[model samples]
Target: MAFSADELRVLRRALALALHPAPLPADEVRECLQLAGSVDEAIREAGRLRAFLLADLARYRTALPGSATGYLELLQDALAAGYRPQPDDLASLRSLRHLPLAAALLARCQGIAERSVRARLARSTAGPSGAAVPAAPAPRTRLTALPGGRADIKPARPAVPGKPAPADDPAKDRPVPTPAEAFPPRKRPVPPGERREAS
Candidate 1:
């Protein structure tokens, strides 16, 4: 947030270039790139620090019943940094309501915590009816070919009038056609000068 004098000058130059159509000098460009990298590092460091603070706040909240003074100090720091109180935190704060500061923070965070809870409830509940509908059953599965050039699917058709149904057979489940049925032999082409032989 508090940039060095050189960084501020470079930032101003970058902004000026943005407003006016002009190319940056080679050294200025390099400096800008270095500044961008530093900014990225700062962002990452801030995130790491936030995570650490949240973890510490949780620990302090757990220690509230046994260590009120320490917990209150940490909680204040956590609250100052925009920490949203959990239900557990609210309960802990309620127990320390005898202390004026604890009571005040509890009142402040209570509204936010309640709104958060309501929002969660609204999301989880169904439509205006508030009723849950059962999911439909899955469709029947189709048979697929096996690795060894096989499939277990039998074609069934309605019998013609006055005709008997086909007999059931276990092997019939997997239809296996003869080689001729699968592919009939093809006739060879005759030469232009050759005569055809009689059967």
Candidate 2:
């Protein structure tokens, strides 16, 4: 963003006044405000131009083989403006290497993109010191010792298919005999009838 000689003067004066406090003349204050507004407008214009360039770059990048020349120019411009190439950009550039400019960009961008990938891979697989970190152990499936192992001293019993399971005793449900039923009382002799005595 190039500032005109008059705008630069206004900005310089504004800064000088800030450092050395003084009552500003109304005209000078107005000039400073105008310069600030122009700066803001310039910033907004730059942003819009960047967005437009990126959009054009992406369009050309996709239609490669057809838009090789335009894509190469736009890519160089974007790279000059500090736009980092993405993985997709690298892939597209790879196919366009038949062109000299496309080949140059492909070489440059592949190095950067590959380095980024390698950095990510290193971070994922290693610790801060760069040593290979051990992965967590998987959970064991069998909780008890395996059969026939020294850890299991007792042999496992096999199921007998022909043998029936033992049932509860039926005598448990029968009632016990009472004491009166266990013994019988003795019978007494009967006396002579009163009618026989009278005869």
Clash totals in order: 0, 0
How far residue 26's Cα lies from its native spot in candidate 1, in Å, is 1.2
- Global lDDT for candidate 1? 0.80
**Shift in Å, residue 81, candidate 1:** 1.9
Q: For residues 1-199, what per-residue lDDT tens digits would candidate 2 score against the true structure? A: 7889998899899899889989999999999999989989988998899999999998997787788888889988988887879877888887877778778899988777788889888789997898867788656787765677756444444657898644334544767567766766666655668557766
Write down the TM-score for model 1: 0.54
Residue 1 in model 1: shift from native, Å?
A: 2.8
lDDT (Cα, 0-100) at 45 in candidate 2? 93
lDDT of 1 at 31: 94
Off by over 4 Å in 1: 114-199
TM-score of each: 0.54, 0.54
